[model samples]
Every structure is written in structure tokens, then in C-alpha cells.
Target: MGGGGGDGRSKELERLWAERDELDARIRLLESELETSSAAPASPAGEDAAAAGVGDGGCVGGGGACQARPGLAHADSLPADMIYRYSRHLLLPDFGVEGQRKLSRSSILVVGAGGLGSPVALYLAACGVGVLGIVDGDDVELNNLHRQIIHQEAYIGRSKVKSAADTCRAINSSIKVVEHHHTLKPNNALEVVRKYDIVVDATDNLPTRYMISDCCVLLNKPLISGAALGLEGQLTVYHHNGSPCYRCLFPNPPPVAACQRCSDSGVLGVVPGVIGCLQALEAIKVASDVGEPLSGRMLLFDALSARIRIVKIRGSSPACTICAENSVFTQEDFQKFDYETFTQSPMSDKTAPSLKLLPESARITCTEYKGLIDKGEPHVLLDVRPAHHFQIVSLSRSLNIPLSDLEEKLPMLETSMKETLDASAASDKQPSLYVVCRRGNDSQSAVQLLREKGFHSAKDIVGGLQSWAHDVDPDFPAY
Candidate 1:
């Protein structure tokens, strides 16, 4: 028994000795990465030497140290804390200390602080991009929390730029964060984009995308653009390495009806997260000169099917209006460009446009509808929302007929209206018809179609069920 106990103790001592050796090796590696080489200049005492001049485009390389800017005196090697913090990155064969140095010297401007901007800003800031600029004019809303992970519940009513900048700073105080609390527009696009090494197109509208890409082309800056809608997303790099600019591919904008916003057609929250991460990756690769960028290629992600495909896109066009070799699209021209007119879409697509297809007399207010309900008026309420949305919520005694299938279902709708009017025993009075949807926009079209089909009494409920939930019943579900 004594021999067995001695054997166990011997094994325990051996294990402890092995652990000590491993720890010693790790410590030595950490020290080697943190040490200032003899050829590099010594850093001043009691200073954050590693992060100096990073905000002013101070690059590093050639001699295993962060190179000083033209006039600034900076550190020779990474600080001990930073060496430990980025140890994983430092250990990478492809992206070693040199890559981190280059990344820390680059500045990036993210155009929107929404879903895509959330992850893009967060990763760039965490990865130690030197100067991170966030430009947005929007305030955080309750609905944005699902996909905009950078914002907190408490920041619901605050400016998105301020909220995102604060979060990025909280994640990495070593980097500099700039907040531009205004939307990018033709007047300021050139000025705002001129300072950054790379531009990220995280905005959600075609007008803004065109304006930004044009500005990038004018400024000779690389553009990493990403978009996510519904359960799908697409990403591409514009204006980099002979890649086509946005205008090169899309010479003409799509029809206004084809431009759908997430506010109209719902989007899966995580869809933007996947695309945003790739955008950040591409930006890092471009900044660090590490990997091949997504230039001249498009990445399509289908979230529902869990698939990602990269296809070759076209190169820069010689006859392209803005990016061709003989092109003369100057900054002055960009300043005078009418993006809204060209795209036929608003720069901010937060809500669907309210159509005035019917006169005021043909539209009934939600309060009037509530009065009709209270007085037991004889009217047929037709819900024209999509079938899936109709299943989400509907008022009692309302018939469901999606606007897409309205022409096919008109006969059924007429029968229901006839039954409602006949049941009221009003032989002389015309049948009362009301149409509703999630928003008031689609109901107007339904009313227009019904009126053309001889149902002149079909009046739209102004502001649709959304206004009904707000003005009629506070307990009704808004979504």
C-alpha cells in the first residue's frame, strides 16, 4: 500500500511539472510579442504608446512595429495588455502582428447604424479599427432591438449614432469612435466620405446606395456594400480593384413598386447579422491587405435554406456613366445629383407612401368606423392584408381576402356585401363596404378596384387597422 501511494504522488508531481513548463513557454511567447526590438525606438514611460497616432492613419510593418506618422512620435511595439488581448490574432500566420498594425491604422465610415451597421460597427470596433466613424440620422426604436444588437433597451429613443458609438467605445477603448449624427446626402456625401480609407454601405434605400457608391467613386475609396431583406441577403464590394460601381451594374433603378422596404415586407432579424459579419470581414481584409476581397463578386445568402453562394459579377464597364475611364462625374456633379428623382424612391424608406387614389369623401376615418361599430351599422368589412398577416390578427366579423387575390375573390366579396345589406333589410340604401389592411396604403388600391367594378360605396378606412389599434382599441395587437 505504501508503494502504491508513492507512485500516485510521483505521477501528481510529474503532472504539476508539465503544467509549469507549459505556462513558462506561454509566458515567454507573450513576452516576445510584447517586447520592443533593438532596432525600433523605445517608448516613453507611463504612456499608451501602442495606440498613439492610430487615429491619424499611422500604419505599421517592415520592421515588426507600428510605424510613426510623418510628425508624431509613437510606440515601437504593441503594449503588453494589447499583446495579450489580441494574442489569438497575433498567433495567426496570415494575419499576424503586421495585419493588426495595418488594421489599426485604417479608418472606416459606416453609413447607417441599423441592423447591418450594428454588427459591422461592433466587429470593426472590437477588432481594433483605428478610427471608426458612424453616420446616422435615425433614433433607435423598440422594433430595431431584434436585429440591431449594438443598441440596448434603454437606448430606444436615443440617436443611433450616439448609441452605437458608445457601445463601440465600451467594447474597445483603444480605438477612436466618431459619431456623425446626420443622414448622408448629396450635399455632404463627398465631404463625409473623403476622410475614410474605406466606406461601408449599410443604408437601406436605393437612393442612398447610389449616392454613397457615387461618392465612393468620386473619392477613390473602396466600398463594401451589403443588404439584407426577408430571409435573404446579398453583398458585394464596389469601386475597388477594377470592380464595378453600383451604377455600373444598375444603370437604371427598378420600378418604385419593386423597391420594398423592411417596414413593408418583414425581414428575419438574424438575416442582417450574417451579411453584416461578412461585410466586416471584407472590410478587414481590405484594410489589412490580408485576403481577397469580395470585389467583382456577389454573395447571396438564403437563410431559410441555410445556403451561401458566391457568383462572379461583372467588372467595371468602360461606358459606365460614373466609373468609366473617360468618365467625368466629378464631386461637383455628385453634389448636384438628384438621387430621389433618379431612383424614384425616397432616401428614407421607413414607411410606405400614402396613396391618394380616392378622394377624402371616399375615405372613412378610424373614429367614424368605431362609431359605425358602436351604432351597429350594417357594413361589410373586408380585410385586404396578405393571408399570412390576416392570420396574425383581425377584427371580429371581418372577411379575409388578400389584395393579391382580390380579382379572383371579388365574386365572394360581392356576395358577402349583398348578404350584409340584405340582412339589414335596407332595400333602398346602397350596400356599405369598408376595406382595411395592416397599413392604409393597400386598402386604397382595393377601394379603387372595387369602385371601378361598380362598388362605388366601397370606402377605405384611413390609416387602416394600424390607426384603428391606436385610436379605436389600445389593446389590439399592432403587428
Candidate 2:
């Protein structure tokens, strides 16, 4: 009787094990199907451009005759061997042979040869982009090696555009590398950008970024822009089919104080690496017409927490000082456009310094602003960082009125001051205006704002507070 019972139990266990194995096989099949479906490519645009019968040879429009025909440039077509070369892309459901041929026939211009540009150029080249035009005036530096991976240590101190072109060629010798060893300024931006199917902004400065955005918008070319600071970065595709240009999102240049540059503030070496990689992904999406590109959406990444946030940007602003519908930029206007004018401090005595100074004031660094309550500073710590940036890192006592917002928020300031004074009647001292921001530039602008508002005692902290922590106060966090 005991032997019979043991046999029944063993049979039941065998049945259960077989059922589990069958379920595992089903799961593996489902996962494989999901991956295959997700990797499928979307449809391509300019279908006629694909079906035009342009082969690996030069386009027929050129003033040259083919071996078999006279007065005709060889149709821009791919060779049979080239087709085999790009077979992996051709095998892709979305890219296929048609998309690979399209990429082989297309051309793109990349502006800047620094952090963002490095990854963009490398990926585009590796993807078999037919022609890549690089424009940059600066030389590679030792500091660039941290993020500018395209330039090797041996290439340091070499012209960035030249080095970048060499690197691109090394990756894919078939692709043409056009080098413009000059800056892309207002004068040359339109002309240079018009020659390519796409324009990429790998620039780090505000003026250059604005120039690239405006030129791409005017030329109706797609622009991919990316920027990084410390552990945070932002990227977006702009000026694609009447979508908002960069200026539409950020109308005028943020005041010098409000701009958070990697040079002044320092950045993690991997920040631009991550951001640039994303920019390259967007560029590839644009090139292949694959997944939806981040057009009109600012994709923000915080490396510290591995967090990504997307902010939808609206279309052109009617009041946008740069690219509004009514805005007209003529050749004459170019002469009057002063790039240096924006950097001038608003509190300069060149005007009326006397009227600029007024009543109560407080001073603090970006780092110290966090400890305002603990320090018991009797003032309001105003964040002068751009509103978008302020949202990323905000403190309890911080009130965000961007430097640009100052003109709009000025009138209410007096009432707020009075309320603060009333609230602190027991203290007898008037409430002071304490200005602070990331690194300290915007806070200086805030101090200037207070002076303009007739607040005399307004003073910006020395080294803006970042300096204070590094030099005067070792215990304070610099970031």
C-alpha cells in the first residue's frame, strides 16, 4: 500500500514540471515577437526622391555626361557593392534598401566640433550618411578629451573641424567630409546651413545657439540642438516643418548672468556624453524617419538621479523678440546687431548709477542660498536663474523671477517689500532683497534689478557664492 502511494506522488510532480516548462517556452516566444514588432521602422518621406532611379553615380543634373550618355551627369545612385555594404540597414524593416539608399544620397551639416558635435559626427558617419559638413573655428584642447571623444589625445591643439573630419573619414572613408574651419556666425550661418539637408547645433554658447536656430528656421532646415551643464542636460529637434524654432522656445538670449555654461560652472564629463548620444539618436531618427523625434519638446535629463523629464514647448510666441512673424532681419539689421551689448552689466555707471541704488539688500551664493534659514539671513533669496532652470533646483525661500521676468515683475516688488516689512515689524529692520542662482551670474543681474528698482543697498556677493564655498567656506557644497 505504501509503495503504491509513493508512485502516485512521483507522477504528480512530473506532470507539474512539464507544465512549467511549457509556460516558459510560451513566454520566450511572446518576448521575441514584441522585440521584432518594436524594431520595425516607420514610413519615409519624399517618396519620389527614393523612386527617382538615382543610382550610385553622380546626379544627372550636373554638367557632365555618363559613359553611355552625353550631356548628362551620372544619376546619383549607389553601386551594387555599396548596397551589400549597407545590407544591415537594408534588412531593417523601416530602413530597408530604400532608406539605406536615401541615407547614402543625403547630406547633413553639423555646427561646432566640441562635446555635442563629436558624438553626432561619429554616429552619423557610422550610419553611412553620404556627406557630412563640419564647421568649427576652435582647436582641440586637453580639456576637450573629457567629452570630445572624436579627437584623440594626439590630436589635441589641432583645429577641431579638421580633426573631426579626419575622425569621420576614419570611421567611414566613403562619406564625404566637408570642412569649414571657421566660425558659424550671422554672416555665414545662412549660407553654410542652406547647403545641407539638416543642421545640428553642437554649440555651447548662447549667441551661437541662437544664430544656428535662426538660420535653420530661415532656411527651413531641421535643427537638432543639445546643451549640457554639470549633471543636467537638455536636447530637442527644432525648425522641422514649421514647428517652433529654438528662439520660439527661448525668445531672447538669457542675460549673461542667467546663462549656466559648462565652462563657468563645470560639468560632469559624462553629462554631454549622455546628452550628445541622445542628440545623435534624434539625428538618426530624422535621417531615417523612424520613431517620433522630440520636436517641440525639451527632453531634460538629470544624470545624478538617472531621471528624464519632457517639457512640451509651445509654437512661436507673438511677443518673441527674435523670430516672431512680424520680425524682419535685413542686411542693415545685421550691422546693428551687437553681440557684446548683451554682456554689459545693467548697473553700469555709464547711465545714472545714482538712481540705480535704493534701500534694503541681501547677498548669498548659490550654495549658501540653500542654508538661508539656518543662517537666519533677514532677506528674501531670489533665484535669478532662468525660470525653466529654476524649476530644476529650487529652495524654500527662493522666488523665481528670471532676469527677463524682472521687467514684468518689477511693479509688484514694492508691495511685496512692504508686506515683508509689515510681517517683520518685530525685527524693525527693513526686509532686504537677497539675489542668488546657479553659479552666481543671474544673482548679479538680480542685484542690478534691485538697483534699477530704487533699492540702494543691493549688493551681489563676491564670486557670487560659488566662490565663497570653494574659498571662504570649505564646508559648503559647491554645486
* Candidate of highest TM-score: 1
Which one wins on lDDT? Answer: 1
Could you tell me which residue pairs clash in candidate 1?
none
Worst 10 residues of 1 by lDDT: 55-64
Off by over 4 Å in 1: 1-76, 425-428
Q: What TM-score does structure 1 among the candidates reach? A: 0.84
* lDDT string, candidate 1, 42-68, tens digits: 343102223332422232221112222
TM-score of 2: 0.58
User: Tens-digit lDDT track for model 2 on 65-90?
Assistant: 11123223333444444555666876
Cα-based lDDT for every prediction: 0.84, 0.67
Cα misplacement distance, residue 455 of candidate 1 (Å)? 1.2
Supply every candidate's count of residue pairs whose N, Cα or C atoms clash at under 3 angstroms.
0, 14
Indicate the residue-level lDDT of 4 in model 1: 94
